[model samples]
Target: MFRLVVACVLISVSLCDDLISVVVIYRHGDRTPIQPYPRDPYRNASYWPVGFGQLTNLGKQHHFQLGQWLRQRYGGFLSPHYSERDFYIRSTDVDRTLMSAEANLAGLYPPKADQVWDPTLPWQPIPVHTTPELEDNLLAMKKYCPKYNSLLTQLFKTEFFLNISRENRDLYAYLSKNSGAQIASLESLEYLYNTLYIESLNKFVLPDWTSGVYPEKMAPWARFSFATQCYTEELARLKTGPLFNEIVEHFRNATKNDGFRKFLVFSGHDVTIANVLNTMGAFEYHCPPYASTIMFELRRNSSFYLNIFYKNSTQVQKIALKGCDFDCDFDDFIRILKPVLITRKQWDLECQNSNFGDFNTIFIYSSIAIGFLISISLLWVIIACFKQVKTNSNDYTRLAIDEVA
Candidate 1:
């Protein structure tokens, strides 16, 4: 078995020539919502000092941990220093996404003698190229889901669109907003404010029961759409635009022809991951986690492999990120890519205790619970004794008054 496995590995390595390129698109870490509608549960601006949709300290740490993971996972794949001949990164122009790429870079490429943080440490700022917001990014979505756009064209007009109104209040709030556009409801002719007045008759309620609806799914769609679009666009930007079709060419070439980069990483969100896979007919029930990463490795004579891993740690755990194959053609290599959710605690626990047939988790949990109960009981007893003493003092004072009388 060992000999056979070694032979198989050698056969796989000989397949591709030297031609490596990688495109990683990921969402910025956890951020405050950009803004909430007037009726939103958490609409107060003070809810987030950064004023919504901005990266928080936690978000930074999440990406920072991922950066460390990448450094370990792909030590030589990416350079510690910037080089014109290798490596390219792009993000949507939004502050959060842009900053996410930067944070990831800080981990991927730590400071060097030439690249220092302010004159103290050598850390250089790597650039993240961006694109215009509204442009169609079918290319980006194609990364994980090649079939998403065509699927979107189908999903766009489905009854599903009407079902998305519940959580989104942007629909009504935008109305009478900007002091523009006539606003009206079907049953009652109401005051016109945003374009909804003209569009409401044309528009029906979204899936959500809430009156305020801009199609809640669409708001999220745009957010993820941009994430997916960047992947394809960023790859193409490295060479030429969509016209050159560098994105597909690169993947196909990497897997079919030459041995491109040792490993390719694309950091992006669950939606982008979902949509791209949806488009490519890669259906994953798993929504991409924050700081989630998708990896592609080309192997054995034009054969390709894909695996996805998520990061949710402040420090590196001494375990490897798992992988799954991309759902391509069977004769061509299409297989099931099951969805999985990995948390830091679970991942850490998995690493520390990998022994099969052992019930360490169960024992650990039970022990912790029993210890907690004991501590609680001791505190309760101490409080009860104090209350009893106070009551006795009051009773004793009354008895002494009776004796004096």
Candidate 2:
């Protein structure tokens, strides 16, 4: 029994040392409400010092702590000093996300040795890449997708959602009267809920009208909206598919190259995190808190494997893939996610509601066919004119010969 226990311990230690790379997708930390309802008491800009939709000091601190947690988790694997080759960070083109990434990096890679430019400052500048929201389909996913929009429209009209709206008519009417904004749709209701939730979190006294239905009555419907973006397989494919596919590619690349990047970080919104979780079928329908994160670790033990973890608060818990175990084989992980994974080209084509390449090919062929027909008609006309002229000349020659005779 003693010998067996020693052998198992040795095997466990070996497996623990096999981590190759990690991908982290995390929400930006807490911020002021996006916007206030028409009747909101805290509507003044002074209430939020950083203006609307910007990160707060509290938010920066939350991300800094999260970064510290990351350092603790990856200290053994990552280099002590910042290295561009080993780490890549991307954030949504939003002020909050950009600032959050900066704050996180401050904690994760504090200046060391020659990296310390200032004796008093412990932080180092790290590059965080971003794309315009209009064109970003990977993290922000704000790029207009016609098919996705059409699906969303269809979803709202479906029996399930229509019933939800019908049942909430009274709630909507009450909220509209109190908040002085239309709250008929789940999306609008969710916005109101978020503002109120943020205000409540900041210890701002809510109006008396909200006491009855502030949280208990409205929370479920608000949370439901988070899942709707990637609720269906088709929606998931068009919405979060590109991000998932990109993460998979990173893991595959790591397998191929020994010197590949060690860590990739994405700073985004709660919706970004929720969409990914829902698409993966591991979401539990709560608003992902500030600085919440989902991590994907690629490991090699006899063979490559994947481990996913979710950190919403103080604790980090291992989350199994919907149909796989905690330590899932890499091949099995890919096979299970095949249904929702999509390439950038596929996403682009699907978003537009048609295969544009095929459409362009057909257009080119049609133009060529039309040009060929026109050329054929011109050639026939030319031949006819030549034949007529030859016939006239022959007649004229015959007439001349007769006259001479």
Candidate 3:
């Protein structure tokens, strides 16, 4: 049976035709938890080497291995020597993600001959581009979108989410009391799970309360909560739109220009991966694991087509966009994704009008300034009137004394 399956796979690849270009979006590898629970015993920064929320040596290795895998898989497509024109890399403005991109680039492109600056160092520095964290919308996590938040508020009020919230009420209360957090939400659970997961990996002994069935129950809800955040079509469009537009443009350009670049690499967080996958209508229920990747391959057979592959952790699975087959045709793929392509105006408006109250802040400051000016003018008028009254009174007293003389 194994031989037969292998034979079929080989035959399918043989029939699939030529690879033109590749775009990959991947999650950064394992790292120290970004933060600890408020009441956790190990809350001190002294416990970690680089302090809170930094990538560990293990995370570096994970990304390095991924780079090697990319090298192995795309060896036939990419040039043996690195060319500035052939490859591009972008990462989120975070230490872990930036470092991961550099590590991955190291595996993808190693120094050779003239490209080597030093005889001792085998690796060469590859540039990874990034924007400011506050300005990032492509990654979707830290972006403040009022429209998206409004959608989430409505979603939370739905019967579906209400049931989930009510069912997990006891669990949330227990977590809040133990973790020293007020009003535990889905985000809190995610952070809590991350802490526990990382601690367990580090060989720390967890409390007996998390021993067997408790963790099992908590894990699913946490994952479900994350998935629910962008569950709706509108929310998904708003959150994932920028990224989807970029990927589609890359595909379109690759086809139009006959594959301008060999590889377009994006290094980002798990939320980044989930948002893109969800936008494609290919997302599974679980949260995206560390070091996961989704690849879009532009292939040219009789004409241009796209092949989408997802690696959740270890295995690569093929996924299709909605209204398209596994190996989606270029035209059909473009049409299906058209509605979610983020416009420049829409993104700017969302960023400018986020739920954090940009308009309200301007109004409040302006109102205070205006009120202060009006009060100053009123005080000046009253002082001037009092001085005039005193002058008139003095003149009248002098006139009376002269008449009496």
Q: Which candidate is the best by lDDT?
A: 2
The lDDT values for all models are 0.45, 0.88, 0.78
Tell me the tens digit of each residue's lDDT in model 2 across 1-405: 324423432343232467789999999988988889999999998888778888999999999999988887788778878998999999999999999999999999999999999999998889999999999999899998988888888888999988998999999999999999999998899999999999999899999999999899989988888999999998998889999999999999999975679999999999998998898789988888899999998877678888788898777776888888877889999998898899988888778763334567768877999999999999999999999999988873355446653
Clashes of each: 55, 0, 0
Model 2 clash count equals 0
Per-candidate TM-score against the hidden true structure:
0.49, 0.85, 0.82
Candidate 1 achieves a global lDDT of: 0.45
Tens-digit lDDT track of model 3 for 1-405: 324433433344333337778899999988887888787667788877676777788888888889988887777678768887999988999999998998888888888878899888779988889988867777634666767777788888999878878987888887777678763567777778878888888887776666642468778876765576568777776777777778778878887885577788999988787777777787776778888999888877667778788888888888789789866889888889877778646776764554445677867877999999999999999999999999988874355447653
Q: Between the candidate structures 1 and 2, which one is better when assessed by TM-score?
A: 2
State residue 27's C-alpha deviation in candidate 1, in Å.
Answer: 2.3
> How should the candidates be ordered by lDDT, best one leading?
2, 3, 1
Model 2: CA > 4 A from native: 1-15, 354-405
Candidate 3 error regions (>4 Å): 1-17, 212-214, 350-405
Candidate number of the best TM-score: 2
Better of 1 and 3 by TM-score: 3
Q: Is candidate 2 or 3 superior in lDDT?
A: 2
